[model samples]
Target chain A: MISNEFYSQENHGPYELYSLGDFELEDGGEIPDCKLAYNTFGELNKAKDNAIIIPTWFSGTSKDYEAYIGEDRALNPNKYFIIIINQIGNGLSSSPHNSPDLMSMSDFPNVRIGDDVRAQHQLITDKYGIKEIALVVGGSMGAQQTFEWAVRYPDMVKRAAPIAGTAKNTQHDFLFTETLIEAITSDPGWKSGNYQSNTEIAEGLKRHANIWAVMGLSTEFYKQEKWELFGVDTLDEFITGFLQPFFQMMDPNALLTMAWKWQRGDVSRNTNGNLEEALGRIKAKMFIMPIDEDMFFPPRDCEAEQKMIPGSELKVVHSIAGHFGLFGGEGSYYHDQIDKHLNELLAIPVPDKVI
Target chain B: MISNEFYSQENHGPYELYSLGDFELEDGGEIPDCKLAYNTFGELNKAKDNAIIIPTWFSGTSKDYEAYIGEDRALNPNKYFIIIINQIGNGLSSSPHNSPDLMSMSDFPNVRIGDDVRAQHQLITDKYGIKEIALVVGGSMGAQQTFEWAVRYPDMVKRAAPIAGTAKNTQHDFLFTETLIEAITSDPGWKSGNYQSNTEIAEGLKRHANIWAVMGLSTEFYKQEKWELFGVDTLDEFITGFLQPFFQMMDPNALLTMAWKWQRGDVSRNTNGNLEEALGRIKAKMFIMPIDEDMFFPPRDCEAEQKMIPGSELKVVHSIAGHFGLFGGEGSYYHDQIDKHLNELLAIPVPDKVI
Candidate 1:
């Protein structure tokens, strides 16, 4: 097993693990003594009604969500108690990297967005004694989970903001995810998910990063030389300095785990594959926001799902950063737009009486 | 070294090797006794002016072009002496797979599209005693060679038809090529381009095919389930039965060699990085065709370059097969269009006297 320091909360702190003991996966595999790593800010109010939940995206930990959580941001910790839950397969959570031998890398169970939301539901309702969430928000795989929460437990989620992600995986997105997975696993160093060290799979990780460089950002990003904003002059410098280093630190198995879940993300799976019927069950004040330049989750795809969900509003955020725009890097124009829409969703009136 | 049976003319027949004797590469490396394998159909006319040259694309052999060369096809053997030259790095030619030890696999020099065209010029002008080519046509990497032929020896090529390819590699296409190259090299079984057998790098080759599946075809291909036309019921079947088997037969090093050439295919490099100046040198009657659904070489990119080339016409082939549409499978709608265009190009009036 790898060292705990790689996934420990020592650096990006204030994390807690909620043990779910022998959690059952959607695919019928079980993770013995399963635990979810999460971070919380502010305190649950007297009524336990001011709690907001944010799930991490693929390859992202709860700590990565800190940028969006601030006094004046969309996920204001000052206004509500914010709980950032790391999705299973993210190293910080119950993932392939940190699990026991029986549930380790090669043996890790298949997890879906539904399973992650169910675990988050357990953490919020059973552990924290929270009856309802003020808002459930995220982007990419996080957005997938947000959609799951809205449909799976409609009454429990008052408002839902799913940014730059779809309720279901499109064929194009599935193919893209397949390429990312193949890029990692095809590395002989991967040893069919039994590599000794992350360093061994360096070339594969580099290829994975290259895939992201092409699809994660729009062509406009390269044409405009947006890497200049990231302090890189050439594409090679951007890939080596930024993309390579970031993905190199990650466990390939953990990434594969999240990617599998990402590929299988479909709210309609819970309702016999009837997407319209599944989306119609959403009682939350829904804000379906998509990045205009995002190749993976284009606005056309988001608006199609939004039109099916009763009372759901489709908000498009325009930026050359493409899907990465949702993460809100320095000088990102869409951050304010996302903040405005999220605030609007949060302000929607709910029933004064508790359920 | 692996057996020559895989690349021999016995199975994929009628090919002959032409020795170039210590060919010099654009990257300053040299291959001693360099040779190119080619197949010719029909007899060279008395005038020796009816020859049409077709260069192979990435992973394609001379035999693969046989499908488009029949009595009623675009490359009719009866009317024109069609010379199908296997691009260097394509196994039958002077590739990493078949070269002598000093210039084999890891030692093979980086080849450019211009170098291939220059060699083809030598083969046509010196070996065959052909003064001018009636036409130079191809798709994808083959199209890259067509562009090189038109610009490098403008007077030698009477007409040029480059389909589903660009004169210069776009940032998007360059990134795609990078992924393909990385996918092969990252395979530990690849052993730094010295794998003992094709089976050793199976995973990497499979990944290479997967990338082609995603980018080589359009979203409509998956949505419409066009693989069904290939007699597969599921995506897994399509991948395992079709994609894997197709790529498993090739040499990884050979693929990488061709990919490097594909990535560096910029006619502007010959004209001091001035694309307009390079395109202006084209004396060939040019018909630039792009596949509408091709994500790698979109029609817009092709049309932009077509406008820069003097006397060039842009023709868009609308199809969901994307880049693969150029190969013209069973019941392909665009094959007739391509045939009609090629016939029209062949019918164009030529100078009364030869140069």
Candidate 2:
């Protein structure tokens, strides 16, 4: 997992590590000296009330999220203290790729979405002595963390926005994740995640990217020749040069660690598989946003979860880019839509008391 | 490629071989001692105008399609001399696995839809002595051949019906097929398509099925838990017992041969990539039926091609099963709709002159 140019700490982002010595996982595992890599914008005031926490998604680093937070954006850093926290197993954090204690390829213990949110909770309370979060927002797996944050600590989060993800992973998504996992595992070069170099499993990693090419982006994105926007003329070049090369540069172990937890993501586990009861615990003002063209977490799936939350509003983000629209892959169409909904949500004042 | 239990002539269908005897292909390749596998129903009338051709889909044999033709169905074996021809590389025909001349796994030359239709034409004319056809209808890869049949021989065909496929393969589908190919080829056991046995590539075959689990069936199919209709209690069981097992039995070389041609399927190649011009040559009463919820070959893609044909109608089959609805995997809903369209298309009188 280590000794590779595939991932280096310096290139990850403008970040600082928040260490939780002997970090205990919610899933009965521990990450010895767990490190969370986070990059922040603006400044935390003495009151620590104007703070926003944004978690990273699958295969995402804190750096990838810089576009979402800017001075001119609705998530303006000038107004709020923005923190982009990378989740465990995302290379920059205490992942299978970097953990010295769990040096073996497959030895990294499973970290649930709940574990990620709990660690973020620890980072906030311990590092900054922050009592309130103005908002906790994220997309995809980050949305799972967002949902967990709102539910696990109902009073700490004043508002929560989860984008293009579900509280409980669907049966379809679980199998979809299975294929992604299989893509890496089936390659003999993977060698049970003990490949000498990430490049040793290059074929498997490319296979992983191939799956993403089909499911990670919307079909319409290809049908309309949207890859032309990426400056790739042919579909072959788009896949060969863009998609495959992207995953070929990542650690397979890090990917599997995230994919395993992603398949089992269930906030409903809080109330013994009762999603309604689990969502009923949320005190934050909720806006459930799903990308309209997203094949994975379609609007209907998000709407089903929205109905479970008492005052939650379902905001369908229109984009032809599907799940890839999470980071505004196209010309600011997704980010612009995201800014509008977030602005509307942020405008509402926090209630005097928690529900 | 040969001498494997994975594929046998007797197990494929009640088929007889029609030898093409060193068949020449459209793409300047030749299959030495080419054989076309076919199963016929009813008798060809004296006029030989009552004969109908139903080509097999990807990985399908003649037996798998028997359910579509019966006394009660629109494709009644009693009235129409129904011929279910197995396409080249489907194992039952002159496939990579069965070709003694092309003994190596990757040695089999690429077989196009045009070649399949060409061989079927030779069989129909040479054996049955049928000059005119009643109707040509198929789905998926078979649909590609149907379009080829109508265009390549405008006067010979009376009616055309293509289901859940395009006249020219879309850019989205081309890449989608790439993932399917990569799933098999990326496996180490595949050994560049020269595996010891199909069982050796079980992991790859299962991976191939996993891809289909996501794209081959409609999202609504999984969302609504339609696997229960297949008498499966859980998704894991359905995939493990049903989907995975179905593909595990097929030869990787055979599947790849069909898939390679499938990726390049475009009747417009005849007219220098002008789809409108290529489709404009069709004179058969065309009814382009696309499965309404199909993720791969969506109704929009099919409708786009249908508009090009002068008198063609787009009949969208309403099914949650998506492309899997091609074979009545659920109830008889898919077949019932197919019969309704085929009956109307078949009943239309063949014009005295070719358009």
Candidate 3:
């Protein structure tokens, strides 16, 4: 029920789950016919030159980020065709919750950011015959995938915008993700990742969400609006009120899968441990914006990348809202700041020469 | 081996555990006479009027915070008496690891911030024979106990310095702590908290510490220092360098017990359901400092308390180190800030109205 209502309102477009074959995930587990949940908006021009790719954030679905793919937005459907791809392990995609055989927790592959992009690449090229993408833009985990897209296929994307994202996973980032994964796998019902038709683990899911929210907003933002943001007058009220909706929407298995990928996310890992070499391999017009208060991918993380990637532009969104400010918040000020840079890039003449 | 060497340093100072009656922990489980291991650096003055109480931080022994109490520091022994009370679950105190009877994970009583102070009260009053404290201070979990001292025994403390701490548990905090407990409990070795005297569950302990460190520092700190901090270049190096030590140094039962108390640390829960009412009970002059960059106890958490406690002074230290900055890093800014206020308090002539 609550999920059905959520789905109806959130997912308004036609979609499909494309099986990409039994690929070995990083965890060395084989997920047969691994499928991805995808949604598309806007008509693709005959040439397919205006196609853009959008990826999901942590515990986010193709539907949540689909709002950005509509008319008048950055990927304005009026001019471009947008494809929202759900990374594997999310509920809509082939995940632990619905997998026929129920993948073993230990055997699950160590999925990296690049793996998601690679899977999406297979879906796009084989199914749609799209040869190029107009842009690849996203925030949080989505932003991570966007960076992977550029690195994996240097010549495929015209430009890339990675907001509130990281080039590679940090220990802190890895730890948080590991914590969430452990929460689900450790549940009595988990049964080593084989639970089916069990009661929702509200306590487990709620605990996971609480940690997630800490990184979403800054201390300043929480101070100013913990009551309004969490929708409660007292701390208990705030916690319970916040968890009620969060638990309703989140799937523990899906959260684990996304967390697994996030923990293992490293484009450099794909290139034999050479991070700078891997980043240097990217050819897309790179624009990296890190939310100043973001606990996951703080501005300094972006700064490190900016210095390493030749010609990469770095814009620090100074706001109290943490990782979530990449969306809008009291830190909306930084949102506008990002838009200015994006507008500048959008206005730049499609270069006279491809070189 | 690394942990043994690290903890064996002269700074650790006379490592030992003291029995504090077999108490029931947060969970209905029971452990016979829990031992609390603590070390003191500064001498207790003659009048004992110059005494300062320093509580241990989460996962820390008295040694972890001892660095701040020596000569030249704010808590210099030459001028003050300092008592460092290790919390119940911190291995040095009684924990699941070294108990005589096999302890069930659920058997531990969820010792709250208040319980920590209450236990310390016994140590000081019964063992040390102290009458009053000039200042009670701590950071993170230690800070939580410091706040408790003021609320539980206002007449005994003249000044309270609670840094990077909250008076109550937030849902977000609970979720994180819960997930941590789940991680340790989920380990196959855990065996429903009955895994005593066998092999320690290193994997689970490693996972718990990994998550704990992530929240303790900011994303910026991670970006700037991950490799250098751990002295490794790759992800594996980082993970191994960081988690291995925690696994070796920590007692699995202690980890679970600490997490249980942290999750249940609702200051108001002890004094009914109202946090403001509990805060209002404090008679000590309060100075609450929350680190601006601390993702765990952000400035907002402290600001919430400042608003509730009458005439409480609030200071926010801007540091990229997040929660850890309150003790080991740029925490000095806050320490200095508190010193200014302490001097002002000391400068004031003692009111003629002595009780």
Candidate 4:
């Protein structure tokens, strides 16, 4: 894989590695010496009914989900055993930037949402020997994997919260993601998926940052000068000082890998493009949560998919932060709102899978 | 002058050029010798009271307004004298790629919206000797100029209609335009705006095209497979064949110049950034038209600005085409609605300027 100093364990703190030993991807390629980086909280009790899985989002690591965990939080450390799994291609996981063998850089196999979910499935069942999960939850790409978990292993996941994401990625979203990919790949410093250092692709990274600057946050966020909430005094500073450099630190190959998979997220492929049939297979108590202003995953798109799932409820959370509200970036209110939704879903007793 | 073959008279048919001698920009830069490209239809009545000025939008030319000039159209050639003036930096006019002498290529001055209106006013007043104009109308960047015309020369413009644009660019829109600029400049081939041919910067143009693919149209347009209306069979074709190539034909420097001005459009600048005070100066009967689904100028954003303009009407047009509806790309219903609004505005007689 393309070795970039940025994606090393030295940069990201306190995450354990679970080796899949050359994991075969659903697309017929394998990540050489594949490893899924993860973290655990609390402990599994007698029957392991208290297990919860928190899948990481795009560009996120296992450690990024710490905001959602605490004794007082919905994902209570004392009450449930929580596992934070970083999806493949998110740098910390066996990604284009961190692979150690023949499959490296752009040669890294194209991974799908299904592949990511299957890997998590393998880790949860084989490593922990847990037959059932109390909850499977995540936001954005994590949400896509959560949908995959519920649909692929219906009997295993009792409750699913796919927040701010969709099972079948919309055509518009595919194009949006295409722009993100174009931003990096088109950079001359990219050198056809091989670059010396992150600094070389500086201009391209800034372009990617501008794309996010436009679509990542809701229009209301800009209209209200909400960057002020983040202590950014001027719009120029918001771009140069914050967004650009934050993204500049990321490996271009890592971003591209995740973006490619994100654009192709489609659980409906399991049922020959019949989303109705695919979502119908979900036995999990599903709460499809969408942020109202999320331009990436608008509430209507999430609601459409939610309608396909039997007994699923569409929960629209309010936030001017848009897709970024998932990270509780500009608003603290969204954090409480998300916790409330999670607690409500947890409180509903899921009917045990009938054999 | 860079002298690209694509923007030559050999390509776009039948438009005249007017010399401005030397033009001074609002930003304190100067073009050695400037020219404005324009087209006119019908005969100016003896009193010159039937004249109408149509300013071109971003990346658009004078010939592009022909769709609105049919015999039975609201801008019926038989009834009103129509002049379509291509804005400076829009390739056909004096721009980065087409200028001659010291102000050639990237050395071209940073022309503002006011500079464009001032040039148009000079052309109309000096050559055409047009006074007490019946109407001034445009869409998008054209709409920006329309607002400027109404504010800068209120007594001259009797009726004003600005469609799918704002009096001042919003912070999000500012950032959105920034991405469009980044797409081209970030390309190594761009060479700081001195690329020899459009083909040299193919990757950057493609990136710019992808950016448009995301924000230029409504998500509903994609959701409904509306590209079918344009005879496209697949999503990939719609992007690669339609969107990408359309932008590829343009000069990147020309696009950048227009986009820079577009992001800074503010009639309120005349009043030291007090939008209400600036818009209040308009004596022309005004109608602000916003496409309901326009992501760039959402009706809410347009309505907010419309509220500041005294007696101005906010007419929300229905278009799944989003901001591209200004060009009538996917729907003709918007054209009919736009014409209906124009005709309604044109029907209202102007109050005599008390000179």
Q: What proportion of the real contacts between chains A and B does each prediction keep?
A: 0.68, 0.77, 0.52, 0.86
Measured on C-alpha atoms, candidate 3 has an lDDT of: 0.68
Weakest ten-residue segment in model 4 chain A by summed lDDT: A1-10
Flag the better candidate by TM-score, 1 or 4: 4
Backbone collision count in every prediction?
1, 0, 21, 1
How would you encode candidate 2's per-residue C-alpha lDDT over A1-355 as one tens digit per residue? 4665655656675788999778898778688889999989999987788899999899988887888988888888998999999998888888887878454468888889998988888998899888899999999999999998988888989999999999989877887888889888887888887777788888888888888888877767887878765568887788899888888888899899999888888898888888899999998999999999888898988998899897889999988878888867775777888888899889989876432
**Candidate 3 lDDT score at position B1:** 6
Ranking by DockQ: 4, 2, 1, 3
Question: Model 4: per-residue lDDT, tens digit, B95-207?
Answer: 88887757777788788999999999999988988887888989899999999999999888898998889889898999899888888887779899887888888988888
Q: What is model 3's DockQ versus the real complex?
A: 0.35
The TM-scores of all predictions, comma-separated, are 0.89, 0.96, 0.76, 0.96
Worst 10 residues of 1 chain B by lDDT: B326-335
Estimate, for each residue in B19-46, the C-alpha lDDT of model 2 and write its tens digit: 9899998778799889998999998998
Supply DockQ values for each candidate: 0.51, 0.73, 0.35, 0.79
lDDT of 4 at A326: 72
Better of 1 and 3 by lDDT: 1
For each candidate, what is the lDDT?
0.85, 0.86, 0.68, 0.86
Q: Check candidate 1 and list the clashing pairs.
A: B22-B33
lDDT of 3 by residue, B165-281 (tens): 888866667655665676576577877666643245666676676676677677676666634433457656655675556554666666676776776666676578888898988
Comparing 1 and 4 on DockQ, the stronger one: 4
